[model samples]
Target: MRVNFTIEGPPVGKARPRVTRKVTYTPKKTSQYEDLVRYTAINSFDGCFDHDEPVDVRIVAYFPIPKSWSKKRRQLCLINKELPIKRPDIDNVSKIIMDGMNPKMKRNKQLHRMVEVMRGIYHDDKQVTTLVVKKRYAERPRVEVRIKRDMGD
Candidate 1:
Protein backbone atom coordinates (compact mmCIF):
# COMPACT_ATOMS: atom_id res chain seq x y z
CA MET A 1 0.00 0.00 0.00
CA ARG A 2 1.10 3.51 -0.76
CA VAL A 3 -0.07 6.78 0.71
CA ASN A 4 0.32 9.99 -1.21
CA PHE A 5 -0.06 13.72 -0.56
CA THR A 6 1.01 16.95 -2.22
CA ILE A 7 1.73 20.22 -0.49
CA GLU A 8 1.85 23.22 -2.77
CA GLY A 9 3.92 26.08 -1.44
CA PRO A 10 7.55 27.03 -1.09
CA PRO A 11 9.15 24.12 0.70
CA VAL A 12 10.23 25.07 4.24
CA GLY A 13 13.74 24.07 5.22
CA LYS A 14 14.95 23.15 8.74
CA ALA A 15 17.65 25.75 9.25
CA ARG A 16 16.77 27.92 12.26
CA PRO A 17 18.80 30.86 13.46
CA ARG A 18 19.05 31.14 17.22
CA VAL A 19 18.04 34.25 19.10
CA THR A 20 19.61 35.27 22.40
CA ARG A 21 17.85 37.34 25.04
CA LYS A 22 20.43 38.66 27.51
CA VAL A 23 21.71 35.27 28.61
CA THR A 24 19.40 32.58 27.35
CA TYR A 25 19.39 31.42 23.76
CA THR A 26 16.44 29.87 22.00
CA PRO A 27 16.12 28.19 18.67
CA LYS A 28 12.78 28.19 16.94
CA LYS A 29 11.23 27.56 13.62
CA THR A 30 10.68 30.73 11.64
CA SER A 31 7.08 31.95 11.78
CA GLN A 32 6.68 31.55 8.06
CA TYR A 33 8.22 28.10 8.12
CA GLU A 34 6.15 27.00 11.10
CA ASP A 35 2.94 28.10 9.48
CA LEU A 36 3.82 26.45 6.23
CA VAL A 37 4.43 23.03 7.80
CA ARG A 38 1.48 23.18 10.17
CA TYR A 39 -1.00 24.29 7.55
CA THR A 40 0.02 21.65 5.03
CA ALA A 41 0.35 18.69 7.40
CA ILE A 42 -2.78 19.26 9.42
CA ASN A 43 -4.98 19.77 6.41
CA SER A 44 -3.55 16.98 4.30
CA PHE A 45 -3.17 14.33 7.03
CA ASP A 46 -6.55 15.05 8.56
CA GLY A 47 -8.89 12.06 8.30
CA CYS A 48 -6.30 10.28 6.21
CA PHE A 49 -5.26 7.16 8.10
CA ASP A 50 -6.96 5.31 10.89
CA HIS A 51 -4.00 3.06 11.65
CA ASP A 52 -0.27 3.54 11.30
CA GLU A 53 1.68 1.31 8.96
CA PRO A 54 5.39 1.00 8.34
CA VAL A 55 6.45 3.17 5.47
CA ASP A 56 9.36 3.98 3.24
CA VAL A 57 9.00 7.69 2.69
CA ARG A 58 9.83 9.26 -0.63
CA ILE A 59 9.79 12.98 -1.36
CA VAL A 60 9.98 14.83 -4.65
CA ALA A 61 10.45 18.55 -4.24
CA TYR A 62 9.46 20.68 -7.21
CA PHE A 63 10.90 24.15 -6.89
CA PRO A 64 9.83 27.02 -9.04
CA ILE A 65 12.53 28.81 -10.99
CA PRO A 66 12.23 32.55 -10.78
CA LYS A 67 11.72 34.73 -13.86
CA SER A 68 14.83 36.66 -12.88
CA TRP A 69 16.98 33.91 -14.31
CA SER A 70 18.26 34.59 -17.82
CA LYS A 71 15.97 33.51 -20.65
CA LYS A 72 18.66 31.20 -21.98
CA ARG A 73 18.98 29.42 -18.62
CA ARG A 74 15.23 29.27 -18.11
CA GLN A 75 14.72 27.78 -21.56
CA LEU A 76 17.41 25.23 -20.94
CA CYS A 77 15.91 24.30 -17.60
CA LEU A 78 12.44 23.90 -19.04
CA ILE A 79 13.64 21.87 -22.00
CA ASN A 80 15.94 19.47 -20.16
CA LYS A 81 13.96 18.77 -16.97
CA GLU A 82 16.63 20.46 -14.93
CA LEU A 83 17.00 20.06 -11.16
CA PRO A 84 16.64 22.91 -8.71
CA ILE A 85 20.15 22.73 -7.32
CA LYS A 86 19.72 25.73 -5.13
CA ARG A 87 18.74 26.78 -1.64
CA PRO A 88 16.65 25.02 1.07
CA ASP A 89 18.95 22.02 1.29
CA ILE A 90 17.69 18.43 1.17
CA ASP A 91 18.23 17.52 4.85
CA ASN A 92 16.46 20.64 5.99
CA VAL A 93 13.54 19.87 3.74
CA SER A 94 13.34 16.36 5.18
CA LYS A 95 13.37 17.66 8.73
CA ILE A 96 10.40 19.93 8.18
CA ILE A 97 8.33 17.16 6.68
CA MET A 98 9.30 14.59 9.31
CA ASP A 99 8.32 16.91 12.14
CA GLY A 100 4.94 17.53 10.57
CA MET A 101 4.27 13.81 10.30
CA ASN A 102 5.19 13.03 13.92
CA PRO A 103 1.75 13.41 15.47
CA LYS A 104 0.08 11.31 12.80
CA MET A 105 2.57 8.45 13.05
CA LYS A 106 2.98 8.38 16.83
CA ARG A 107 -0.43 6.84 17.47
CA ASN A 108 -0.22 3.85 15.16
CA LYS A 109 1.46 0.62 16.23
CA GLN A 110 1.63 -0.58 12.64
CA LEU A 111 3.87 2.27 11.65
CA HIS A 112 6.86 1.12 13.66
CA ARG A 113 9.50 2.51 11.39
CA MET A 114 10.02 4.65 8.36
CA VAL A 115 12.58 2.49 6.65
CA GLU A 116 13.77 4.41 3.62
CA VAL A 117 13.72 7.80 2.00
CA MET A 118 14.56 9.07 -1.47
CA ARG A 119 14.62 12.77 -2.20
CA GLY A 120 15.06 14.74 -5.38
CA ILE A 121 14.54 18.08 -7.05
CA TYR A 122 12.77 18.98 -10.27
CA HIS A 123 11.56 22.06 -12.13
CA ASP A 124 7.90 22.90 -12.11
CA ASP A 125 5.56 25.79 -12.79
CA LYS A 126 4.91 26.17 -9.07
CA GLN A 127 6.63 25.16 -5.86
CA VAL A 128 5.32 21.85 -4.54
CA THR A 129 6.39 18.93 -2.39
CA THR A 130 5.04 15.45 -3.00
CA LEU A 131 5.22 12.75 -0.34
CA VAL A 132 4.91 9.07 -1.12
CA VAL A 133 4.80 6.49 1.69
CA LYS A 134 5.09 2.88 0.69
CA LYS A 135 4.42 -0.09 2.92
CA ARG A 136 7.60 -1.83 3.96
CA TYR A 137 6.51 -5.27 2.82
CA ALA A 138 3.50 -7.12 1.56
CA GLU A 139 1.53 -8.30 4.53
CA ARG A 140 -0.66 -10.68 2.57
CA PRO A 141 0.43 -13.76 0.68
CA ARG A 142 1.30 -12.95 -2.90
CA VAL A 143 0.43 -16.31 -4.46
CA GLU A 144 -2.97 -17.89 -4.24
CA VAL A 145 -3.26 -21.50 -3.20
CA ARG A 146 -5.18 -23.79 -5.53
CA ILE A 147 -6.98 -26.87 -4.32
CA LYS A 148 -6.29 -30.15 -6.12
CA ARG A 149 -9.32 -32.00 -4.73
CA ASP A 150 -11.41 -31.53 -7.87
CA MET A 151 -8.71 -32.20 -10.50
CA GLY A 152 -6.54 -34.95 -8.90
CA ASP A 153 -3.61 -34.13 -11.18
Candidate 2:
Protein backbone atom coordinates (compact mmCIF):
# COMPACT_ATOMS: atom_id res chain seq x y z
CA MET A 1 0.00 0.00 0.00
CA ARG A 2 1.10 3.58 -0.72
CA VAL A 3 0.09 6.99 0.61
CA ASN A 4 1.12 10.46 -0.47
CA PHE A 5 1.07 13.67 1.60
CA THR A 6 1.54 17.23 0.41
CA ILE A 7 2.58 20.30 2.41
CA GLU A 8 2.60 23.97 1.49
CA GLY A 9 4.48 26.92 2.95
CA PRO A 10 5.40 30.51 2.22
CA PRO A 11 8.92 31.85 1.61
CA VAL A 12 11.25 31.17 4.53
CA GLY A 13 12.07 34.77 5.54
CA LYS A 14 8.53 36.08 5.30
CA ALA A 15 6.90 33.35 7.38
CA ARG A 16 7.74 30.25 9.35
CA PRO A 17 8.75 27.35 7.17
CA ARG A 18 6.74 24.16 7.16
CA VAL A 19 8.38 20.78 7.45
CA THR A 20 6.71 17.48 6.63
CA ARG A 21 7.84 13.90 7.16
CA LYS A 22 6.88 10.81 5.18
CA VAL A 23 7.58 7.10 5.60
CA THR A 24 7.22 4.23 3.14
CA TYR A 25 7.46 0.47 3.51
CA THR A 26 8.87 -1.91 0.95
CA PRO A 27 8.67 -5.66 1.49
CA LYS A 28 11.34 -8.15 0.60
CA LYS A 29 10.81 -11.43 -1.27
CA THR A 30 12.76 -13.68 1.11
CA SER A 31 10.99 -15.96 3.61
CA GLN A 32 12.32 -13.95 6.56
CA TYR A 33 9.55 -11.43 5.78
CA GLU A 34 12.09 -8.64 5.94
CA ASP A 35 10.89 -5.18 5.00
CA LEU A 36 12.61 -1.93 4.17
CA VAL A 37 11.04 1.25 5.43
CA ARG A 38 12.26 4.64 4.27
CA TYR A 39 12.01 8.01 5.95
CA THR A 40 12.19 11.24 4.01
CA ALA A 41 12.61 14.75 5.39
CA ILE A 42 11.58 17.38 2.88
CA ASN A 43 12.64 20.96 3.31
CA SER A 44 10.02 23.31 1.91
CA PHE A 45 12.07 26.29 2.97
CA ASP A 46 12.78 28.56 0.03
CA GLY A 47 16.41 29.42 -0.53
CA CYS A 48 15.58 33.13 -0.44
CA PHE A 49 16.51 33.46 3.25
CA ASP A 50 19.95 34.80 4.06
CA HIS A 51 22.29 32.50 5.95
CA ASP A 52 22.55 34.94 8.88
CA GLU A 53 18.81 35.41 9.22
CA PRO A 54 17.20 34.09 12.40
CA VAL A 55 14.04 32.34 11.39
CA ASP A 56 11.36 30.87 13.58
CA VAL A 57 10.64 27.34 12.48
CA ARG A 58 7.49 25.38 13.05
CA ILE A 59 7.44 21.79 11.82
CA VAL A 60 4.37 19.81 10.84
CA ALA A 61 5.22 16.16 10.45
CA TYR A 62 3.01 13.32 9.23
CA PHE A 63 4.22 9.90 10.27
CA PRO A 64 2.56 6.94 8.58
CA ILE A 65 2.92 3.28 9.54
CA PRO A 66 5.66 1.34 7.85
CA LYS A 67 4.42 -0.82 4.98
CA SER A 68 6.33 -4.03 5.71
CA TRP A 69 5.82 -4.05 9.48
CA SER A 70 2.24 -2.99 8.96
CA LYS A 71 1.12 -6.60 8.85
CA LYS A 72 2.47 -9.16 11.28
CA ARG A 73 1.71 -12.79 12.05
CA ARG A 74 1.67 -14.05 15.59
CA GLN A 75 -0.02 -16.72 17.65
CA LEU A 76 -3.68 -16.03 18.27
CA CYS A 77 -2.91 -16.33 21.96
CA LEU A 78 -1.46 -12.82 21.84
CA ILE A 79 -4.85 -11.36 21.03
CA ASN A 80 -7.13 -10.07 23.75
CA LYS A 81 -9.90 -12.41 24.80
CA GLU A 82 -12.54 -9.73 24.38
CA LEU A 83 -11.81 -9.58 20.67
CA PRO A 84 -14.20 -11.81 18.72
CA ILE A 85 -12.44 -14.18 16.37
CA LYS A 86 -14.80 -17.14 16.39
CA ARG A 87 -17.07 -15.51 13.83
CA PRO A 88 -16.06 -13.22 10.99
CA ASP A 89 -17.03 -9.66 11.86
CA ILE A 90 -15.52 -6.43 10.62
CA ASP A 91 -15.68 -4.54 13.89
CA ASN A 92 -14.26 -7.44 15.84
CA VAL A 93 -11.54 -7.95 13.32
CA SER A 94 -10.74 -4.27 13.41
CA LYS A 95 -10.60 -4.25 17.19
CA ILE A 96 -8.46 -7.33 17.33
CA ILE A 97 -6.04 -6.03 14.73
CA MET A 98 -5.74 -2.56 16.16
CA ASP A 99 -5.96 -3.06 19.92
CA GLY A 100 -5.16 -6.71 20.56
CA MET A 101 -1.38 -6.44 20.61
CA ASN A 102 -0.84 -3.20 22.48
CA PRO A 103 -2.00 -2.24 25.96
CA LYS A 104 -2.16 1.42 24.98
CA MET A 105 -5.30 3.44 25.63
CA LYS A 106 -5.77 4.84 22.15
CA ARG A 107 -6.13 2.89 18.89
CA ASN A 108 -5.94 3.91 15.27
CA LYS A 109 -9.44 3.62 13.82
CA GLN A 110 -8.43 4.09 10.22
CA LEU A 111 -5.88 1.34 10.53
CA HIS A 112 -8.47 -0.96 12.06
CA ARG A 113 -10.93 -0.36 9.24
CA MET A 114 -8.28 -1.02 6.65
CA VAL A 115 -7.34 -4.31 8.23
CA GLU A 116 -10.99 -5.35 8.40
CA VAL A 117 -11.42 -4.81 4.68
CA MET A 118 -8.26 -6.70 3.87
CA ARG A 119 -9.52 -9.70 5.82
CA GLY A 120 -12.54 -9.97 3.49
CA ILE A 121 -14.85 -9.23 6.41
CA TYR A 122 -15.76 -5.68 5.34
CA HIS A 123 -15.87 -3.62 2.21
CA ASP A 124 -15.55 0.14 2.15
CA ASP A 125 -17.76 2.24 -0.11
CA LYS A 126 -14.60 3.84 -1.38
CA GLN A 127 -11.37 2.19 -2.39
CA VAL A 128 -9.37 0.46 0.33
CA THR A 129 -6.65 2.72 1.69
CA THR A 130 -4.30 -0.06 2.82
CA LEU A 131 -4.21 -3.84 3.10
CA VAL A 132 -2.53 -6.28 5.47
CA VAL A 133 -3.11 -9.99 5.37
CA LYS A 134 -3.14 -12.30 8.39
CA LYS A 135 -1.91 -15.84 8.16
CA ARG A 136 0.06 -18.47 10.02
CA TYR A 137 3.83 -18.17 10.22
CA ALA A 138 5.76 -20.81 8.28
CA GLU A 139 7.23 -22.54 11.32
CA ARG A 140 4.20 -22.10 13.57
CA PRO A 141 0.55 -23.02 13.30
CA ARG A 142 -0.44 -19.79 15.07
CA VAL A 143 -2.51 -17.18 13.21
CA GLU A 144 -1.36 -13.64 12.42
CA VAL A 145 -2.60 -10.53 10.65
CA ARG A 146 -1.21 -7.34 9.21
CA ILE A 147 -2.02 -3.72 10.20
CA LYS A 148 -1.77 -0.75 7.88
CA ARG A 149 -3.23 2.77 7.39
CA ASP A 150 -3.50 5.28 4.56
CA MET A 151 -4.65 8.88 4.10
CA GLY A 152 -8.05 8.59 2.46
CA ASP A 153 -9.69 11.34 0.54
Taken over the whole model, the C-alpha lDDT of each candidate is 0.43, 0.24
> How many steric clashes does model 1 contain?
1
Tens digits of lDDT, candidate 1, 47-151: 332232223446555556665877777666655445566667776676555554444222234776643231112111122233342111111211111111111
TM-score of each: 0.49, 0.19
Scanning candidate 1 in windows of ten residues, the lowest lDDT window is 141-150
True-vs-predicted CA distance for residue 140, candidate 1, Å: 40
Q: For model 2, what is the error of residue 121's alpha carbon versus the real structure, in angstroms, after optimal superposition?
A: 23
- CA error at residue 46 for candidate 2, angstroms: 33
Compare the candidates by TM-score and give the number of the best one. Answer: 1
What TM-score, to 2 decimals, does candidate 2 have? 0.19
- In candidate 2, stretches whose alpha carbon ends up further than 4 angstroms from where it belongs are 1-90, 101-103, 106-128, 131-141, 147-153
Off by over 4 Å in 1: 17-35, 46-52, 104-153
Worst 10 residues of 2 by lDDT: 33-42
Error of 2 at 110 (Å): 31
CA shift of 150, model 2, Å: 4.4
TM-score of decoy 1: 0.49
Best by lDDT: 1
